[model samples]
Target: MAKAFKVPHTLTLLFGMMIIAMLATWIVPQGFFQTFINDANREVVIPGTFSLVEERQYLTPWELLTAVPRAFAAAQDIIFFVFIVGGVLAIARRTGTVDALIGRLLKKHSDKPQKLIFMVIFFFSLASGAIGTAGEYIPFVLILVGLCKAMRLDAMTAVGMTVAGYGVGYGASAFNPFTVLIAQGIAEVPLYSGWWLRAVIILPFILIAFHHVWTYAKKVIADPNQSLVADLPCPLEGKEATVYPELNGRHRMILGTFLATIVIAIYGISQHGWYLYELGACFVGWGLVITVLGRLKFDEAAESFIEGVKDLTTTAVLIGVARGIALILEDGQILHSIVNGLSMPLSHVPAAISAVGMLVIQTILNLFVPSGSGQAFVTMPLMAPLSDLVGVPRQVAVLAYQFGDGFSNMIVPTNAVLMGIIGIAGVPYDRWFRFCMPLLGKLMLFATIVLVLAVVFGYGADLEVASVFINNAGVVS
Candidate 1:
């Protein structure tokens, strides 16, 4: 059999992709879909209103270099959030609270690692599926790695329980504002309108993910050297994996503080619509309190915090450069062109086929536009109308968009969050993909079947024509 294609170093591959996005601007006609502000106050694209405009925005070589810096500027909120998360993790680690807890748990369940695996994966899945908390898990990636080692598991298992678990939740989310909510709003469906079906679909996918990760983890435990990154310098390299300090009362208090903050964060997200900036502040306050509680002298705390930042410096740069890929596409004004090209084929397909086709297009588009909200804003406008022509419900199109925007992030090099977290844990892209591809393939298959059923059954098919901004002069009748 021919060898499968391997993704390159994350940076090298992303920079190359950035150049491809730039070149696409020259080849694809510059165009955009007109947008309108909805009652919910979101700037969603006006359906069926795409037009060819004079192409004014183009990137020169120097302009391309400038895009990286501009991306950093535009993404400062996320950039700082990443730094703050790193510092918080460093403080927590210094307190030994995280390690102590992991140690105790391992000691208690050392003979029943499968129970521990399922619980951790499920916790992450619920957090991500319910709240769209993808990036917030980065700081915990290293901590999970430590725990996995203590249980005789590999880096893949650690990520599978955390990052991939989040991916399943995120991909199958019924109410994630960044993906599901925005796409539904654009499709003119009630926010979280068909959550019952989505909730049902999410369970099977999570179970599939858990089984795959658990099986691999058990194998690694049996033969420790069988681990994919057995030779890599992991975050817990040189530490004894089998032994952990007994948890003291102070440690319990610190952990209680951390857990309470997580609950508060979730509450804020669910009720108050808090996002990255506010969540970053939560971590900031957590770090301050933990540092004082742990009684680390100022100099010692500062050193650990800086050391954490230094470790994540590469991860941070990878994220900023990944942002450049999207920026170049936006600057080149080819993102809409690509969307237009992808939408053209669906016009003639059967409703069921068109629904699945939307999934395929959105999945491919995710490689170029990795941001969930960004992809929703770009694709949902066109997809919703295409669904109307083919007799599929607009909500089904939103389903396609949400599923497409999500699962691909698990393996896409352009996904800065996944790549950054993997890099921090010393797992190569190739190794991670090897573990994720088969599982992701199964999830994609499941998603396609669900989408086809939605189309056939008219799931959430009600149309509120007056609420939708139909382009009378454009494609809509």
Candidate 2:
């Protein structure tokens, strides 16, 4: 008998990547790009300023061992944010709100599961595209998993719905501040300029994503053997599987309080400039309010909160290790060398082809640099100027940045948000990789086509107008 080869555990996979990154420090040339703060108050790379350092910077094996804690410290904001959301949602689940809602959804949508799938993908996509929501959706992962099980689908289907919306929204983001806004501002294009195309294009991407997920879901429902994670343990095991509490005033209050918190959080983000800390505080506040409303003894609520966080331990560790991988590259000083080498050839290509080339470069770079805004900071300055040399519009470059960063997040091991989602869902990285790679191919193909069309049509004409207006205003002064 032949035994099947197995995928390593998530921790093993992440640590393996960290080791590889450490070894690369010894071999890859250490280099850097000179940077300056632009008018927008961003530190941006000065074009053509790349230089190899006289002394090489390489990380030691000892440093690789210690990078874990340092990465946790660096990513503490996101880690704590995940904890807060998990703890708060656990308390809500104890209130029977989650179970009640699941029961209601199953009754209403079970007959036509496609409706549930579409709505889930659409709502998630809308949130990510409009307001840059990703980590906030962590609370929904288990909730959707339970609902899908009730609807006779598998865990992979649940994950596919949540992440597909998230990934595609980002890929075709009309105005995501984390990726698009930062990329645009760094590229020196007008803020939110040339957004109509993204807004229009997002629908098709969403539809394609919906079709892919629904198709898989249909198969899983038709035959249990068709499920990707059938052999894997249940994510909902050891946790409350489901509850059908009768609707009560307290449950409504909790649901309202949760929805109100999201609205307030969104408002704070768009207006007062909130980040993870503020958002975490908001979720914590929701936890406190629900605690009082659910009438839990202090000890009971506290235990539930701790239990909720306990389940997410793997997710947090994976996130920290993922950050550590990026840290190693930074310490090695090979980050800029990779960026400099990959971008040079694009300068020699035709405009339309160069536009597509930017997409490819951004996709490859995303594997090394997974943070959306972080990638913008590292890549945009070069991509913005390179657009001029190759006859691609700066706005199109920003679009390339958006498309590349958004879709690749689904498959990139360094994407902490992704690791968190699938970990919480109990889907192994190998299984997730198997499911997501094909979808990424389709979305990437669509994005490449759009970038070429944008180049053909001159997408950034308004950048010239905006620049002229700024220059004329300076002349008057």
Candidate 3:
């Protein structure tokens, strides 16, 4: 009899990627990009600074073994932030705020399933576009999963809505500090130069996402057997909420603090340049406030927080390991080579095709460099010069970068936020892949069109009015 091949767990798969990266260090050419601090005071690579490293430093077995710990250290901010969100959310659940909110949401939109999906997709996308939120949605996964179960939908529907919104919002990010703003700063364009186009584009992409998710959700609702996750055990299998708790003054107060914390976090991120540390502190403060108002005994609140963190142990591991993949590639001294090699072709292509090629390169690189800001830093400098050579505006290059980074984020195994969110929802990586691939394809198609149109219409009017294709020999034609 033939044996069935079970897909590896996310952790195993990430470790395998790390091993590949380590091996690439030995096989791939060693190279590095010279860096300088730009006007933004950010370390950015100087154009034409890429060169072969004089000495090849191959990472040894000990380094591979230690990459995980190094990655944990590098990713601690995000890891701790995720834990804080989870713990505080768990406290809210214990206080019945989660259930009460779910009950109210379901009461308002359960029978109106399309409305619920649209709201989730729209609001999630809006947050991502506006504030660059990604892993922040992890706290919503289980809540959405339980709510979907009560509505006779699968967990895939829940995650699909969350991830689609995140992905599309990022692809069409207007004011996203993490991706768009950083890319713009690195690209040396005026801040938010093409905001109107990005703002208008997100709506259509959101519709595309909403339609894709709603199609799958409708099929699953009509026939549970058709669910992509039919065989996987439902997270809320036995505890389906038939009766949702009513929101009393206490529950309402707790939920109010939740919203207030989010508002304050947004203000801080936009006005004061807040990040994981501040966001985590805000959530912790919210947890204490809820504990007081929800009237959870000190022990109960503590237990709830502990249990929440305990549940996310796998999630934490996934996020940390995912970071290691990039670390291995970086330590190998091949990351710049990968970027250079991938981009070499664009110089030979036409302007419109070059724009698309930039998108494609960014998409592939996202698998290795998953962080939005990190990808921006690594690619934008190289791409900015390359865009001038290939008849692509520097601004369009930034747009393509955002498209590649944001859209692929939904499916890239190396993306810690995607893995963390699915891990919490109890969805297997393969299952999430199966469910998200179509949506990703649809979004990518729309993104391709947008990139092409941007190239045709001169989307970034403020920068690079003259785009001339140049050859490697520095001859412009």
Best candidate per TM-score, number? Answer: 2
Regions more than 4 Å wrong, model 2: 1-3, 38-42, 238-243, 462-477
| TM-scores, all models, native as reference | 0.91, 0.95, 0.94
Per residue, candidate 1 scores C-alpha lDDT tens digits across 46-150 of 766778876566678887889888877876777777788887788777888877888887778878878877887777777787878888787678877887777
| C-alpha RMSD of each candidate structure in angstroms | 3.9, 2.1, 3.7
For residues 57-97, could you state the per-residue lDDT of candidate 3 as single tens digits? 98998999999999999989888988888888888888888
Estimate the TM-score for candidate 1.
Answer: 0.91
Per-residue lDDT tens digits for candidate 2, residues 1-477, read: 898987899889999999999999899889999998766676677778999999876688999999989999988988888888888888888888888888777777889899989998898898899888888788789899988888889889889999998998888888898888899888878788888999899989999999999999889888989999998877787664454767678888998998999899999988887988999999999999999999987788899899989988888888888888888898889889999989999988899998888899899899889989889999998988788878888999999999999999888988888888898888989899999999999999999889988988889956756676879989633
Ranking by TM-score: 2, 3, 1
Looking at candidate 2, the ten consecutive residues that score lowest on lDDT are 238-247
Q: Judged by lDDT relative to the true structure, which candidate is superior, 1 or 3?
A: 3
Off by over 4 Å in 3: 39-41, 237-242, 466-477
How far out, in Å, is residue 95 in model 1? Answer: 2.0
**Which sections of candidate 1 miss by over 4 Å?**
1-8, 37-42, 55-58, 239-243, 462-477
lDDT, residue 234, candidate 1: 76
Cα misplacement distance, residue 233 of candidate 2 (Å): 1.8
